[model samples]
Each structure stands twice: as structure tokens, then as C-alpha cells.
Target: MAKPTPLNLLADLAQNDTEAATRELGRLQGLRTQAEQQLAALNKYREEYRARMQAMAQDGMTATRWQDYAQFLTSLDGAIRQQGQALAQAEAALLTGRANWQSQKRRQNSFDTLVARAEAREQAAGARREQRANDEYAARLARAASHRQD
Candidate 1:
């Protein structure tokens, strides 16, 4: 855990934002996958139905039966079109989610960089203070030794 400095607080917030974005991206990916699977199944079923209708027609169906098959095929085509639109929307959402995640990640990285630089600066300042104390101690020892000799 980092100390509760302003920089650390900002970094924590950035981390949280990034995590949320990642979760959203995952959800969007799942939706896109589902859409793709559904579309594929619908296409496969439509083709199978068409094949069956062709076979039945070759065997000479009644006019009424023919109309039923043609009407059903039209409905299936509409379903396919609707499914295609859903898939396209899912893809668009996924694309936008990815961009959001990337932006969040970049923001998190920037906060991390700022925190690192601040820590380095603090450490350098501490080192300077220690060096100054050591120099002062040495000078005191030298003066004491000369006083004793006198």
C-alpha cells in the first residue's frame, strides 16, 4: 500500500478507473462473441431450410405448400438481416470499449510516472540531508581535537 500522498491518491484513482474500463471491455467482448455465434447459427439454419425447400420442390409440392415455403423463406431473410445489424452494433460497441480501456490505461501510466518521479525527488533530498549531517559531525570532531591539543 502506498502512503496517502496526493500523488498516490491520484494514482489509486487512475488504477480504479483502468480496472473498470477493463471490465467493461471484457463485457463488450462477450457480447460481440455472442452476436457472432448467433449470426452464424442463423445463417446455417437458413441455408438448411433453403436446401429442404429445394428438395421438396423437386418432388412437386402443392401450390399452397409452395407459397408457405416462400413466405417462410422471406421471414427467415428478414431475421438474417436483423441479426446482421445486431452483430454490427456489437462490433461497434466492442471497438469503442477497446478505445476507452486504452485511454484509461494511458492515464494510469501517467500517474505512475508522476509518483515515481516524486519518490525519487524525496529520496534525493533525504540523501542530501544525511550528507550534510555527516559533514557537520566531521567538522565538529576536527575542532574538538584542535582544542584538546591547545
Candidate 2:
């Protein structure tokens, strides 16, 4: 069996876990902010395209106008498709980041639990050692008192 780490060693692990959790949480937050920004930008582009298409329709012109509208519609379709792909990619990245954060949290919790258990065991051992020392001192005092009387 692997030897258990000494109680003194647990402090380092606890500190490391705390630091890791903080870092992972920060990373997750950053990824979420980036994803939201990308989605917002995509929506803005789609809205701008809608406005332009409406303005073009109001003119009501000739064949050349129809061709221009067709070209505009095709470009709009491409932008919408690209936006959808980007949104999907952003969502996937967010989900992966969330999972990574959750995994880190679980590791931190495990380390915390281990450190607490180790500390409790160390405290109990210290108490036992103290009690034994006290008992030995009392026995010695009793023996000295008896010798003095004799």
C-alpha cells in the first residue's frame, strides 16, 4: 500500500487545490464572456443585413435591381450560415470549458476532504500523546512522594 502523506504535508496540497480552483473558475468565466460576445456580434450582423434588404425592397426598380437583390440575398445567406457555424463552435467551447471547471472543482473538494481527515487524525494523535505524558508524570510524582515518606 502507498504510504499516507504526513499531516504536515497536507497544507501544501490544500494550498495548491485552492489556487487551482481559483484559476479554473477564472478561465471558465473568460470563456463564457468570449462566447457571449461572439453571439452578440453574429446577431448584429444578421440584423444589419435585414435592414439593408428592407431598404432595397422599398425602391421597386428594374432587372438590374432584381439582380442586385439576388446577389445581396446570396451574400446574406452566406453570412447567416457562417454565423450559425460560429455560434455552434462557441457553444461547444463553452460546454467543454464548463466540464473542465466542474472536474477541477471535484478535485479541489477531494483534496479538501483528504486534508481535513488528515488534520483530524493528527489532532487525535496529539491528544493521545499528551494524555500519555500526563499519566506518566502523575505516576512519577506518586512514586517520589512514597519515597520521601519512606
Candidate 3:
């Protein structure tokens, strides 16, 4: 059984951090998508309402009916504006999340590189040790053969 390398342990922790960052980025992206969908729906409803108002105008609406339509359209416009703001905020959050994920990924890669280097060093050291052991064994066998000949 080989002892665990410190570099390997650090690499594991870095990988965990990367995974958490990825999850957070995914959540932010979901929120951004939902905000975009809501904004689209609001715009679509506003367009449909405008079309209805136009049709009513052709049919000769009374002054009161026109006033009511204007008021409702104003309210829709306000709602649409609010939704746009919300969408912007969500997009900003998504951008921040992406940046964080990238940073974590870079950290993980660095740790992985360190681990690879450590493993290579360990392997080289093991090889040297094995070679030395074989050389000593051969030397002992040569000495024993000389004594037997004597």
C-alpha cells in the first residue's frame, strides 16, 4: 500500500471547488433563461393588446373606451419596463457566475498539473530504487560465486 501524495489531495480539493462553481453557474444560467422567457411573454402580450386597440379604433370606440385602453397600455408598458430591468440583472448575475467558474477551472487545472509532476517524480524515484536494489543483488551473487570457486 502506497501513501497518498499531498499533491493528489490538493488536486481533489480543487476538483471539488470546480464542481461547486459549475453547479452555481448552471443555477445562474437557469435564472437568466427564466427572466428572458418572462420578458418575451410580456412583449408578446403587449403586441397583442396593441393589435386589439387598433381594431377597436377602426370600429369607432367612444372617448371613454379610448381613455381606458390608453391607461391599460400605460400599465403594460410599466410592467414591461420592470421585467426588462429584472432580465438585465439576471444577465449580470450569469456573467459573474461564468467568471467564477472559469477561475475555479483554472485553479483545478493548475492543481492537476502539480499532481502530474509529483507522480512523475515519484515514478522516477521508484525506478532508481529498483535499479539500485538489482545492482546490489547482482554484486552479492558475483561475490558468492567467487567464494565457491576458491
- The candidate that wins on lDDT is 1
Clashes of 2: 0
- Candidate 1 per-residue lDDT, tens place, 1-150, comes to 345799899999999999999999999999999999998999999899999999999999999999999999899999989999999999999999999999999999999999998889888998999999999999999999999999
Ranking by lDDT: 1, 3, 2
Candidate 2, residues 17-77, lDDT tens digits: the string is: 6677667667766766776676677668767866776787787657787778678768767
Clashing pairs in 3: none
The best-first sequence of candidates by TM-score reads 1, 3, 2
Write the number of the candidate with greater TM-score, choosing between 2 and 3: 3
Off by more than 4 A, model 3: none
- Please provide the root mean square deviation of candidate 2 (C-alpha atoms, Å): 4.5
lDDT: worst 10-residue window of model 1: 1-10
Please state the error at residue 54 of candidate 2 in Å: 3.8
Q: Count clashing residue pairs per candidate.
A: 0, 0, 0
Candidate 3: lDDT of 19?
A: 99
TM-score of 1: 0.95
In terms of TM-score, the best-performing candidate is 1
Off by over 4 Å in 2: 1-48
